[model samples]
Target: MTAVVNEQTSYLSDRQCFAILDRASEDLQNGLALRAFLASIALAALRPEEARVLRVRDVELVDDGTGWLMVHPQAQERREKDSDRAGTVRRVPVCRELAAILQEETTRRDLGPDDAIFVLDNGRPLTAQVYRKVWQQARAAALQAHELDSPLGRHVSALRDARIAAWLRNGDQTAGHILAVAECAGMSAPRLAERFANCLRKPTRDEIPWDRLEAALALPEPSQSTSTARRP
Candidate 1:
């Protein structure tokens, strides 16, 4: 389906994002379909198509506790989307928390690099249709009715939208950032910005520079003599 331009203004808050991720990451009993889907989008800003087709080979985990997911043409036999064009690639970083989760899954299945990262009971790659169904069920479990109805994480793509919007609001939306996100989303910078405007409202607690705020307070308070010097 074609996108509904400006159709949503309520992207996931940090709290909501965590709420969803935490639930999805709970256990393999319920299944990793939603867990992998949520982690792929929430952690890396991967589009639905890109995330669904992700293979173990595309994941690069560093010994230094950082990792990245590769979204590119090599993941497929045929071009899946614009970003899948020959020579086009985006390396989406995976945070420590998400990395640990992925590592656990990889170890559990003893998967080779060529295997699918997110799989099913029979150990098959998840299709987009199944991913969306799992997403809805997971959302119902993780979110309240109002939140579920809201644009926040409404579609799988919204996770990518929310992550990029958070980056922008956190004051990291430089040209380089825009270009990187544009590559991942397969859209121009302006288009990406316009679509995610709603999610770029007030900064979240994570975005605030608490260290800077504390540093300002650490400055010595004015003494009576110092105050007198400034008097008219």
Candidate 2:
């Protein structure tokens, strides 16, 4: 029965899933943009484009609530004419613990409504290729940590897969949450579900491993030199 269940579900073990999330979060905390990008996608189930376009203004806390991190879409048309990208404005409620990080990041930068949230140290917007490379590096680190072999590391969408997994595991089984996420990501809900349903399962609080998250926060702050070095 155990084997049957394992074969039938084919889901990543809880520990493995948490490890991936943990590593990604650590990367983000360490000021690794690519890692942070991948981690956000994994935690929020956002599209790569959406993650890349996220600016300080895009995130908000609803009614001063600590549990949600609203993610608004980017105003791409205004930023670049002839750019066919359109963003959907949506609110995402995150773990209350993430509030400080959100606050610090927003205040740390000089971002306008149209500015790209994530950027290179040179002040250039993070291109898809650059983000993709960071994702590759993160995947390699994750695989090496686990001593596992995976060809999926080469795929940029893998981080999205990880996000879907986290979402589903967190109890977003109904289409409501997924739809909300997709709309915020500027994509159709049906399309997201159709392509990524397998990763969507019921969510549980334990799925997030908040204990591990708290520990990561306890680590020392990065030196100003190192921290400021990544800034544009």
Best by TM-score: 1
lDDT of 1: 0.69
Per-residue lDDT tens digits for candidate 1, residues 1-232, read 1112245465666676666666665545446656756777777777776776788898899998779878764444245333334456767788897788778888877989888777775766667777676666666778787666666576777777677766666656666866776665555566766766653455689988999999988978899998999999
lDDT of each: 0.69, 0.54
Q: What is the lDDT of residue 101 in candidate 1?
A: 75
Off by over 4 Å in 1: 1-8, 25-30, 73-87, 198-232
Highest-lDDT candidate: 1
lDDT of candidate 2 over 92-166, digit per residue (tens): 655444554555455556557666656764677778876655555555665554333434334655555554545
- Deviation (Å) of 91 in candidate 2: 3.1
